[model samples]
Target chain A: MIGVNSSPPLPIDYLYNFAKELFIHSGYVYFPLLFDPDVEKELKASGLCSRQHVEIENSSSNILLRDRESWFVKGMSLESFVSSYEKLAPESYNQHLEALYKELPFLSSIDDNPITDKLCTIILEILPYFVSKNRRHERKKLTRDEVLELVSEKLNIPPVLPEHARRILNIEKLRVALNSLSKARPTCSKLPSGIVSKTEFEHWFSESLKAEIIKNERRKIKRSIASREKFARINEKVLAVLFFAAEKGSLEIEGFGFFATEHEGEFIIYKRTGEYALKDYYGRIYMFPDCRVAIRTNGTLDPFVIENYKHPFLQKHAPGQKICMRNTLLPSTFTAQNAIFAIQEGISALLYGYKYRKRNGYHSLDSIPMPGSTVTFDDYMVPKDHPRILRGEVLVTNEFR
Target chain B: MNLLDKIKKAREKGKASIGVNSLNTVIAIIEAYSLDSNFLRFLDASPYLIVERKNTGSRFTRKPDLRIPIFPLTSRRNYLLAKQVIEAIGNPYIRFSRAPEEVYLSKFLYRENPSISHDELRNYHFEILLRREIDKKKSKNRFQ
Candidate 1:
């Protein structure tokens, strides 16, 4: 029940694809003939061939296969298949084949046999050529001497001489030199006199030398500070210059007040004045607790209004005048931790608000600060009779002014 | 020089002697010395033929039942000189056991003259004495 067909029924390309898929899916790419009994039975049932015979030829691409009827199937080995197909279809069926080849132990059993050893040597020789910069640039083959030179360069040492001159160096002489160099090197400097005794003179000498070097550095520092009085006069002028510079620099004006920068001669006053044309500063602005304010008036001021102030206020006028305008300056509830937390939240809100406004054309939260703006004392106002300006039962004059 | 000339020189230097109990060993010593007349002269002069009883029994008896008389050299200088002559001929007598008498007899013979004869005497009197001693010991044991 055998069919004698002179030619294969299927096209070589189609048969190759089928066999390649079969080999890959079953992990039999290397040992194509090594089919399990069940798989062999399945293959026999398929009627492609009665038997399978695979042969791996000398480290070449070609594989010679013999069927049950003594028919032949010539193709490439697994390595050749990977190399040839890696480029054609890098992400297709061939990609899977290459991956399986790398993952599976295809040549795991190959040892130092003549054939395998020769193949390895040849591969090692040609590997550099494959990785070289220029593909078409033909360079001379590396001689044994050149290879040795490359090894020396890799080891970060001088290249050995060629041929007979490259014998092993005298180990005894090298060991002696190394020992002498180690002994000649300095030792730890901090040990006490009695720690390194006469029996250990070399150790003591090296340690003492190191200690002397450190002591000399310390002495140099002590000598530099011997004439401190001469530098005191220079230090005073430096302090004055720094004070003036800081005064002219940008000031963080805070508290319940209205700030204005004024140039009085050469000095700038970051003025905080509290005088408004409004009747109720409480509803208009809020003041932090424990702030002091100064109130001044030339006319009668209501006692009930001054007594209702949340903050202490000091009132002052021209000899006998009524309390009217008051200015307060005090640290806000912005502790370092609170300030950092506020800054983080403010920044996050600003970024989120900016992005939200950019996308939707409006801010989602009304309380969030606008980008490039900071919370300041100008955002709040002081009330009348505020403790900032008013004492327990009387108004005090502005001491800072 | 040839072997005979060397032996003659060894004998003249007073180096020749043989073990008193071992006939085969004595014969071998004589034959070796005959190759050199100087060695023969030393052998003839030696007073005592130092014998090792244990090693000599094999060459003397078939059933390994034998005893032998051992002679000692008498003079120290002669013994030392004779030893030097024997060493020159590349043959030396090493004593495994201590025997002051044997050492003295050997020294005396070496100082006398290098022509003493002991091969026939060794084969006869020394062997008979050993046999008679062995017989006397066996008879005494049987009677007891």
Candidate 2:
């Protein structure tokens, strides 16, 4: 449900690449990249600052930057980009900007000849540390005309003649087939429009415009979807096997495994419970409490701890506290298969990813005065079929949620 | 000043009339801005504009973009205010450079307590929004 997916994180790799390239090209010492309202909190928290509508790329998120700068970079890893920026001397920052004073590379005009399928068939790719990041409800606003414009551009045909709307798509002679309504076209206004993203935007595209494009265009979209399918598929299959055992009070994957599945609104949520071992970066492990993983089928929304468990990494504040899915990137359209893998990652991250010394997250689980240890999950001996879970068959919706 | 503060001080300051219903809309507008980026923090809610649909009378009333509850801030006032707000927000990583009436919500701060009459701003020509803040340190560096 847009209800659950709500406000997802922005494109980290895209922004990082955009930021690094901007830093290299802009002669100005500082510049803000205005984003859509959706990404405002996320970008601001990352220390990237700046300042919409379907009436093209309108949204609170789209208005993030109030400047002129390029945002497309072919390839650059986030870590390498950030590390390099960190290594740059203060003098180098200015000198670097000055180098572009005469020939601004970042400001070079772009060839907007439909940046669709042309870019890459190769690849695709947020943090939890920033608490209170703007995670608002999805403001999906899209129109038929805009979708038609994009389709027209991609198909490379003269503008559709008003006299022959159906004939154009029905021509059947065109090599590049675009997604079109079979018969009765839905009214544009009733059809929502909002994502200025190829992402959340893409999900919108896939769902709203489910027509098959040429292999070239679909390759890029398909590659992203396929990779995620691969990542989450393995997790789902593996967990199902392990969970089969866990249901009988035996083997549990990682610390715990899935036991039951239930329906919640539009989502099919799989539940995982057990004593999870969270090992900080220091190698010492802490048993986390109330470890309940309730992964909903909706791809965009991360897993939630059904027990209302709030940890540094798992805090979405949705129906149940949603997991942040830190570093775990999902394409705009999260498929059903991705949930289990995401659950696996959520539980695994809690297992060995924590850094005891730094307490690396937006909030700390430890109480004030440095309890010196994380919250304990000592009930490893608890049966996977403990009555607390089995008896509470139905999910009690969190009212404060 | 925030919207509430401005509405309170409107009569004392002899400011333009901000209708009662407009306050709700204006508050909604400011909330939109705050949910956005650092715009609200740098901006005060002084640009609360009341858009009443007037009859196309003796004069040709150009349709203001305000037909919808919200639209892009591409007017000159929008540009100037965005520049001022960006500077005031003092973000070390970003600097904004927008055009005149070309784009998003870089709202207007109609804090002109007395000068511009309501009639003067009662058309498409005027770009009124609801947010304003000035960081002296950053603005000084920018304007200097």
Candidate 3:
């Protein structure tokens, strides 16, 4: 009787875990795979581990001597490892995997096998079939060379033999393919037990072409979101708030408290009970009331004018007015550097982004109205001698600097 | 001229990111993607990444997740290079996600494995992985 949970440890399973830890520590996944001489031969023969001589882009390009150590390089990818491990790794390698598997201790146990059959090893698992949907049942058994050609075309993975065509009359895969085309699962046309339609060889080859495409797309989006998530952790958030505060030098995220979590978009939530003075280039100063700012991880300020005031650029003319960033540009990918620029830019816009004379955006800072628009709220205007002017730049004397 | 040296220099110059002084952390990322074999896995694996428990990552709450920040403790000026390096690494897990970002002693590796101290694994297991990845990054066919 078979044990319920006793499947043999697959090489893929062992390598998967190792690759994860590697990716976490480093952004990349890799391995050192130069323990045996036959590895190169088996890899070349089996069409797994498909990395080639990459001439290191050093200033001195003529260093061919050192360049010769290409195969002995440190890292092998999961795909390359997966491709190679099926042949090079021991079946028991999975059992040997630990939170710590070393080179000599575990990796060295992999005894290499000389290449016997090239295409059969990684075909179904590593290399998905490139068969088109309409061509599922076009005819009888395809020759071995035909199958190899199909696999090669799928990923431009060069054939192992590198020949015109390998002409085996009866490869086991094609035999199965033939059996799929003709016989019903319960032995033949005269089958007894199983349903005929449930078993089709088409699922093996035809369906995977579609599956691989979808998998690739999902992989792209998932990977972007996943790695991107790493940039905005608690460690980074604390640093960002501190850096922004240091750079601004006056404002503090810790005015009340800082709340950074996924729900609130990793924010530096702060409330200040005093007024801030905002000035434009044309010597126009506006006194703003007590402000509360929520700096998001994306480097955007929310409810920017939390004390409720109105200007043309404000989304609304009431409390919790969000500033419009229609005139600014920010980075696409999220990182701390990008965050700095975003926060700085956001602040800069609030501080000196308006032209009182031109009345460029929603409303001019001065009393000048747009061609057909009216100016509201002369109440917040402050004279030059106001005591609570936190931020505003005005030209005082030409020779002061 | 050396990759590690380059990374170190970048890190030093990039001290503006604050508290990201760990060379190994940055090296792990760059080294993993430097190999073509590993780089290609990004294309193959969907969500090939580590979830840092439930609520730890920089913007785990929302990454659909564009509105966030990470000060680059290293590779500061070359933010785009950092991006490319990240893209190149791709997720290698393929059909799998949700693996532990940092792997510790697996139960299968040793019988009564809890008997051994974390120090032993730190000295032997992890060090070996890091060294191998480093060696690979320093290889002739590096980043192929």
Candidate 4:
């Protein structure tokens, strides 16, 4: 039978409670077991008394129980004994034990021979600097040559190396250099083709070409105005016909009663009791004023009518019969009443008869009709048998000898 | 005749006319019965049988034949009688001249229970079952 260890130094509850409290404070699910003879002896010497027992048994369970109290106490002081752990168990100690366990092959190789230990020592010495150089390379943007120089200086390695390794190390740097150069000097093919140089194109567009366009536009406007003036002249001609027709009853000028040599397609007309030169075209006659009246009638009255007219010539030359007035000489304010008034005034002037009398007892001035009165001519009383007409006919029949 | 005897006599006389097609008369009878049970009970106890007849031989067979049945107030007789009462109540609201039997059953016996057949269940029993089913469905959908 197994005898119980030395009065069971720490009660099971106390040990379990202490372990639980430590576990809770550390927030660890599992903690390592620590049991060292020297550490236990030191603890005992220090007067931190704790019971200890030794047991040898066939099963691992008995051994674990025999050292349980010691392991707990030592494990509790693990932080303090960290340096002493190597001295206590130098052969089994390893700082990277967890890593070595994870990488079993590496641990096995290192454990197998001294050669691997030497290799690991060399790798450890250079690995940190190489890692730092690689980290710097990744962080900073540098040219390929710059990166190569930095790597060589940092790792204390020879700068001269295989071209492939150099390229591999500076691949990102090479790409960055190529990208920057491409942006700075873009390929000619990438620019727009068939384009003039910038300065020449801008000079042509702004100064010479723009001035030419403006000059051409002004010429076009002048040409348009010239054509418009021509069109207006034609339009005035068309409208002139209507204006003439509206003023005169007919286009014939003979109805205006003027005696003159009858040119072919032309005639003289008396307008406003003044002789006018007239010309006919296409069965229509146009008249122009040739004389001014001595006795002026009111300008607002129709100038067409000689109000005092009682002459046979005047009766024959009534408006719409042989000749008519264009009435252009009449004032713009002339209305139908003014026309009637002018006719009355003219007839009054003619009826009073001009103050000239012939020595033959025949009136020198022709008798004129009064306003609101009709003048009837007796065809028999006219001078068909007149002695003056016979003398004129005789003279016209005889030769000029 | 006694109440059962009168029902029997009415049934025999072919007077158990359940006009499922005419719901108004059925509803009127039901309402009348509800208003005054004595009057309906007296009518139920009467010996007159109201039997609907199919047209076959004559155009003048418009009136239902009044006769008496041998048995009265049995389950089968009560079912036919209840059906007649339901038809009498429901006929007026229906527009068409002819109505399906299911419409009568659905209105009177089924009430709110979408399940259950009026022909298979007694009127009073179906009424209670249908009310409970309707109440249960109502409670379930109350929140929604």
Best by DockQ: 2
Q: Kindly report the fnat of each predicted structure, to 2 decimals.
A: 0.00, 0.00, 0.00, 0.00
Candidate 4 per-residue lDDT over residues A1-401, each given as its tens digit: 00122233333323332232221112111122232234335645855345455333333232122234322221222222233333443333332333333533322222111112112221222222323333564666554344334434543444343343323323344344334333333122211212224343233323332233233333433443443343344322222322232223223221222221233222122234332211111111112222211112223333333333223223442432211222324343333333334443443332222222220111111233335445532221323334543454212111111
Cα-based lDDT at residue A349, candidate 1: 23
Q: Residue A248 lDDT in model 4?
A: 31
Model 3 docking grade: incorrect
Model 3 chain B lowest lDDT segment of ten: B93-102
In model 2, the runs with Cα more than 4 Å from the true position are A1-265, A271-273, A279-285, A310-319, A362-401, B1-144
Cα-based RMSD of the predictions, in order? 43.8, 26.2, 34.5, 54.4
The DockQ values of the predictions, listed in order, are 0.00, 0.03, 0.01, 0.00
| Span of 10 residues, lowest total lDDT, candidate 4 chain A | A23-32
Residues A55-164, candidate 2, lDDT per residue (tens digit)?
Answer: 11332223233333322222233223323431323333334334432343321221111111101110010111111111223254333333323333433434523332
TM-score of chain A of each: 0.15, 0.27, 0.32, 0.14
lDDT of 3 by residue, A265-324 (tens): 234433343444555445756665545533444444332555565655664567766666
**What is each predicted model's overall lDDT from 0 to 1?**
0.30, 0.34, 0.36, 0.31
Model 4 lDDT tens row, B33-90: 3323232243333111211121233323221222222221112222334454444434
Runs with alpha carbons beyond 4 Å of true place in candidate 4: A1-240, A244-252, A257-333, A351-401, B1-144
How much is the lDDT of residue B64 in candidate 2?
A: 32
Candidate closer to the true structure by TM-score (higher is better), 1 or 2: 2
DockQ of 4: 0.00
